[model samples]
Target: MLSRCSMLPSSSDVQSLQGLSGIRHLAESRRFKAWFLDQFGVLHDGKQPYPGAISTLEKLASNGAKMVIISNSSRRASTTMEKMKHLGFDPSLFVGTITSGELTYQYLKRRDDAWFAALGTSCIHMTWSDRGAISLEGLGLKVVENVVEAEFILAHGTEALGQASGSVRPMKLEDLEQILEQCAAKRIPMVVANPDFVTVEARALRIMPGTLASQYEKLGGEVKWMGKPGKIIYEAAMKMADADASDSIAVGDSLHHDIKGANAVGIQSAFITCGIHASELGLDSFAEVADISRVVALASKYSSCPSYVLPAFTW
Candidate 1:
């Protein structure tokens, strides 16, 4: 269980709830006009779409609720959309997607902000594959193979480094200490494209960019995170949905990313326990309703009190 200190900043106005019933509860209650849905555990498990995910999306769409699929994926929005289509999701179901990769790319491409403008053109690109580097093209940025010759570090996460070593497991601190040490010595700023510590992929949780970025910050390296738990992404999502905070609710499986982020932005949140915390909460199946006390305890542990709790995203 995650301690309170580990959770992201939350809003003081939103009090703790007893438990969540189901997605239909929110719809029936007419509590929100727009829904920001998470893509990973809530919609699919990486390999395929969840059993009722498509239909649930259809139901929400028919209800005239604005839907935006939010993701902490390191891939660009277009890439993410392509993958979602391949996985059998209807593109017309949601208004648009806001991915970490897309946000990072937009920031770099426009350089409208002070932080992004200060960044140099040459960077050491770190990713699982060359496809990850595709986001940097047409932005006048150069990708260098070596950290020593780079002006900044573009890190997707440690997963790529682990894969390069022929390991299917998540990368640990020891696996990245050497590279992190070099960047730290140079005081190089790192652009973390994805800000999720762990993501569910086919029932298996894997470490993501946020984990490595946290370690890098601990080692005295400057890091810029572009995804959830940060206010920027939430603001971007709200703008895309064109909804006010009071009428918007964020639904996701991770407390650290989804619930905490929603609270941070003063938007209502629904905690879906069947995704990443299923085993920890003793839930044997996605359809199994979690004990109210267990759900309350989990929320208390994270110091984030979501407005509702549900076993899964179903109508």
Candidate 2:
């Protein structure tokens, strides 16, 4: 494992990171021990690499610091890894990766013995169609078409579910409730993979798995959240990094999820301003307190604030 308590840049040194040109120097000089890279905007956008990402990653990797990507991506880890390689990102640069899909699979695998015994094999998996048709038979569980035919249900992402609701499309709460009612009548439990209510894509807001899960819980149905800011995902990332509470850092763009999750585990965090909330950058709120003021307020209300803020991952 890499050394966690190794000397970090003091406040004066931190000021240097505010500039992109200086980052190369600091990284080359061993200012940071390891980087907790955010996969989305920092490396590749959902479909492709952002400009300068490859060079930045290559430079950092050549500088000798350990790099690990921690993402909320719902795709399987293998898919993400393959995409990275396709984009010409040196796979060796990343010491480890923790994706929501991979983590969810592990969680199911470990609890299989107990879950299988209690729930039986018959199950209906209700989630977004993008989650793919996963068969639990390989996991020793049976797959059923609808809730009525199943004893249990595994609910993953909700994109496909949202789109299929009505002609207006993008499943709304009212439409999802109808499906939940069907499962509820049969007393089926669902395992929620991604637990975000909504995610900002570029500038527009879109529903996520958490949005449906929240509604399900309100209707007395059971759900499980996977990935960041969640304790399980945080714990798994730490274990992979071989890092302790005080020795690690979490860098992400989401204030509610990334920042809050880091605080829950007592780890330091750096908020990247470009991804979900790009408009907040270069504002007084950001300049006055580094992190978003709302996040600063939340941190103060619940716990300590982030260690620093950058305009973007590169900066």
Candidate 3:
């Protein structure tokens, strides 16, 4: 049975979370020795780093905080690192990065586990044209153009791909539905490289791999989710951080991903309300303080309350 903590907050209960403060204030109060930070909403708006994110990460690093980025981005760790550098984040500030793409690559590379070993060599890749088949390259897996020829499906979300291709329009849901139908009819198991349903990009939301995976599952197809809100990615991050879950804290904007994943791994969580859910909760920006009552109510509604709540990630 699913725990109440895993339940999502209702739209009507969408409100500000209480205990909003700066990152430094919460760190001092919670005494977390390690940090697992989210990328899209917490550190950047998908295009650039949030105002104080770089400085704050630098300060935390200087203070000897062990940090690892736990992101649901479909990009591999090396690719994510390069993107971070381009967006002005120093690689030295964090110990390591654990992305869904990297995890998927590792799984395919190892192929030791039963599920992975059972996955046939031919796959239908639903990835960005620019990203190409880099993640699956060197794995000896054949990329097929059609679902009928595929033994499995590899999804990397459509919105990001469209953006990477420089298209102003978003991929339509109907197109995705058709693809899901074809895969489901063929009984193809899908591997969702990024398990985020939607992510915010400069105040606009885009569908992610998790959305497609969920839809496929609902349509009677199997899905292998590769990132947060799941335990596998958190375990990988924990190993990279070299810290126990008890002493670690996960900081992210999405309660569904960060908070739920941390709870599953016995780590405390700090929700950054200003990131993804800010506007829906009626907040101006990451800089604004949220109403305490509304925040508490929101937590109660989701049942996945964070140990701490911050207006934004700052020191």
Candidate 4:
């Protein structure tokens, strides 16, 4: 366990890379009035809850902490709630959730902005039907089979290629190169709802839509990002939480997504070292503490900083 600090920072506005033992320490400090949490790495690793994660959340809720889930998940908020409930987390504990998929669906349905209004309805949808697909049925968007017939690309999920022989079909990054080349040639714009390059999936990492969106950009295709590190999503989460920027803290594992987003929003951030960047931090287990210098170096490499660092999310 990390040595408990004698005292946590008195203000959430202070940006310090302090080491923290658990969520209980932060809760006791009462520095942050509300919490904006990331769903994947900070909460569960897809299949099961991280050690002490459920209890930590329960304790925070019982203490009346206003918490909101701000996720880069391509699944809608309701779908997220279903998974949370299945994992034995009480969804009511959170003020609400803001997911990239929910934002994408809203944008497509409302077409409230100039960029969305200019986009045509025909799109080649890359998705994961293996683990609950994100349906675009009500968006009034037509789903075309390929780039030739599509006007745009809505990337919700690209890792699963649908089931084959009763097994979940796996897709390679190279597999999408051909399709990406086609879209680039036709100048079809792509909307990446989730801007996380990869997500933790049961002790392993799975490629997310963000990686493909980045690749499409390299291929000269126009890409629109919608998730973490984006100011809008952060604002949406804060809106749901009714949190003041100075009184909130964002807890997440990804430096680029969570830390960078918090930096953009001018809030406190807690970095979980045991998540996606575990190997880079030289951690072999969740309980293994990360070298503070290396943790700082990693934060610099990602161009973001955390106000507090923890080996794992616990209480």
Candidate 5:
């Protein structure tokens, strides 16, 4: 483990970077080599690719840069790959991809004991609205849409909860309580595939998998979060990359998840400030707009400083 002090660069060190002008030149210089791009904000918002996203990717891909798509998405890797192609990203551009769901399944199935030995005889999965995208049952895991039908339950965020149902969505606090009651009585454990509280949708905020997981815990149900900010996920990412902590770069938007995850492994990071709360940027001299360095300095105070910062993925 890297000592906290060793990972931090003092204010003078940051001042030496020469700011946005230097960043632009560095990006344009074609020296950074490879890119590990995220899906939600950097490339697409659900079904639509953000403007300039395609061209920006094309620019990077054309320059002989190796690209990897790393996401905390609940969708299986194949489904995410299809979405990438649909969003105008050439599938050929990326060499490898990893998702939280894949990691969750692998983590469970490979344990010395059969997965979910603690959860009784059977397990049920409660996935997001994109149900057809993944099938845990193939691995001998049972799948159920409702928690009442489950001996054990696993949940990611619900898309329907954010849309037409709005507050009426089934993952509400009351419904969660009912599920927790059932599980507690039966003594079942819940595994949460993605544990982020909220993710940015362009400028708007939407619920993430962690919200449900945390709620489950409050009800005295055992809940395990399976993604970044959680050690398992970052370790899995490093294993996939076959990378040493000092040789990798983790580019993400959330300070709590992305920045902290990378820092935990001694991997460097590039923070994306456009996501979550941009209003706070103005408080830091519009650091959100000009460059990523300010965000790095700001994170340093909180013990989660990133190695570098970048705007949301734009050319």
Candidate 6:
């Protein structure tokens, strides 16, 4: 694997996790020239930037860090950047933004890959109704009303589907059983743009598009994942930053998404404990530290590991 710790024997389990209180030490070290950051949990909670997130980005920028946002969000990169700006983060802090939606759109437009080449144009587009708007406007794909007419399925979010059906709360997997079964029976292929089961929205866990993708897989339907945990997005991010895997560090809150993605791509990674796994790690408060063994066990559960552990993305 390409990393600073390449001397260590290649193994599934990480040798050790270096603990840190904030990003200041990494900033001072000037180790990684390229930074790949997650959006929802690490930078902001969808409404506002994290306590020290803005300043941390500013500090990294000042230190000549080439930062790129590597988010699993279904919205396009430009849309995600606009949201970051609305959340009080300076848009100039990032060199580029790579999101699942942008990748999905590009694939559909180019029809370059084998999976994308065989697909028909008619699709069932699943996206948010209340927020996080996405569009298939330029892809030449038709959005059909029923599964019978759909040549493929585009899953971006499920929370908004619930909202559209008169429910405002997060949805359970069983809620989509009828629809998924129909698609499965027809052998329809689904493209999941965001591969996160859940995400932090104002400190509350809400169902994401990945959960629906998992359910579809269980029903024997084909699924194409577009975001993190998939190697292509990371490779695209590195290419955009003009960085090599050995010189990049990914900072994110989701283990299965960010950490595992970095691990697959041979890049160093830091895990922020304040995001999705905070409760699982028994963190009573944000300041509550997670025991090393517990952290190791939890990472193992996700079949992933982190190179460094931090309480948050603080300065």
Cα RMSD for candidates in order = 5.0, 6.0, 4.5, 5.3, 5.1, 3.7
Of 3 and 5, the candidate ranking higher by TM-score: 3
Tens-digit lDDT track for model 6 on 1-315?
A: 754333322234443333433587776774688999998888888878878788888988998899999999998899989888877888888999999988998999999999999999987766675664466667887776578888988888774332223333443446555678889999999999989999988889988889889989998999999999899999998999999988899999898999888888999888888888989988865534577677777877787778877878877
Off by over 4 Å in 1: 1-21, 130-135, 161-174
TM-score of 5: 0.76
For residues 251-304, write the lDDT of model 4, one tens digit per residue.
Answer: 999999998888887877888888999999898887568877787777778877
> lDDT, candidate 6, residue 135?
66
lDDT (10s digit) by residue, model 2, range 74-186: 65677778878897787887878877767766766666546534655565554555435433323655555556667765555564342212212235446666877888776
Arrange candidates by TM-score, descending.
6, 4, 3, 1, 5, 2
Better of 4 and 5 by lDDT: 4
Candidate 5: tens digits of C-alpha lDDT, residues 1-315: 462434565544332232333333435653455455567755666657766667766766676555667778776678789878877778877767777777676666765555555554345444455433244544555554454656677665544222211122334545555655666676568777777777766556677767777777776778877777666666665666566565455667676777777767666566666555354454232223644456555666555765555555555
Better of 2 and 3 by lDDT: 3
CA lDDT of 179 in candidate 6? 74
How does candidate 3 score on lDDT?
A: 0.77
Candidate 2 lDDT at 259 equals 63
Give stretches of model 4 more than 4 Å off: 1-20, 160-171
RMSD of 1: 5.0
lDDT of 2: 0.60
Model 2: residues >4 Å from true position, as ranges? Answer: 1-32, 112-119, 128-137, 161-174, 184-187, 200-205, 279-304
TM-score, candidate number 2: 0.74
lDDT of each: 0.77, 0.60, 0.77, 0.80, 0.60, 0.81
Lowest lDDT 10-mer window, candidate 2?
Answer: 160-169
Reference-based lDDT, residue 73, model 5: 78
- The deviation in Å at residue 134 for candidate 3 is 5.3
TM-score of 4: 0.90
Evaluate model 5: give its lDDT. Answer: 0.60
Give the CA lDDT, 0 to 100, for residue 36 in model 4.
92
